[model samples]
Target: MGRAIALGLPLLVVAEIAVFVLVGSWIGYPWAVLAVLAASFAGLMLLRREGMRAWRGFIAAANSGQHPGERVIDGIVGLGAGVLLTVPGFVTALTGLVLLFPPTRSVARRGVQRWTERRVSSAVAGDLFGPRKVRVRRGAPDVDGAIEGEIVEPR
Candidate 1:
């Protein structure tokens, strides 16, 4: 799987470059290039604004000593979106924008969860709730009895 993704990344990059060039040529290279630059800049601006808001909310959540798990997850996701938004391409910018928004991210999270549930061959009941460690059966308990996080581990 790792190898496949590694190989696929360059292929995707090539495809994106081809599309960019084709569209740029059709629209006139100067205008297309300018548009790409403008969109990338706009994306970065939006990311900065959203990130600030999310940070403020996180600070508030942490101040109250409430579960800050979701905020941390959102921060991680936002950071990734920030990186993608900086890439010079319409498709990546669109995806990055979708990820930057809360409603869209919620939908994406559900889709990813469904994918994960299907990938696992055997059901591990109380799996996420159970201790993640593999130790002596009678060793000290490890479950924190909390909704630890909202991180979506990549496939």
Candidate 2:
């Protein structure tokens, strides 16, 4: 992940710079950079504040004795999105906004749900060091083959 990010960052920077140059040539460099900075900052601020609001709601639901695991996940997503929006790049900022938006995010969330279902379902999520999961169907086996509790003497 780190290596992917390290390599991708430079490419992203180059793309952003090209866009910046194009916009700067049309409008002026100072205004273009300022606009990008302002937009990124605004998006970050909005999502960060909204994420906090969602976190507070999650806490409230948890305190009410309800399962808030999904809320916690949303909080995590929101935090990541918020941070991404703060970065100085159009793509990153747009990705963050998509994550923050409910309609778009719901699709992303469903993908996550499917991934969790395949990779780690309830058994894995429920416990890490717990016993391995085993599914037994009906009529598999029973204790009727042996006498109850007491062992028979060897003939």
User: Which candidate number has the best lDDT?
Assistant: 2
RMSD of each: 9.2, 11.2
lDDT of each: 0.66, 0.67
Off by over 4 Å in 1: 1-4, 109-155
Candidate 2: which stretches are off by over 4 Å? 112-155
Tens-digit lDDT string for candidate 1 (15-70): 77887889888998898789779878877886787688678867887788665545
Model 2: lDDT equals: 0.67
Candidate 2 weakest lDDT stretch, 10 residues: 146-155
Clash numbers, per candidate: 0, 0
As a whole number from 0 to 100, the lDDT of residue 33 in candidate 1 is 85
TM-score of 2: 0.64
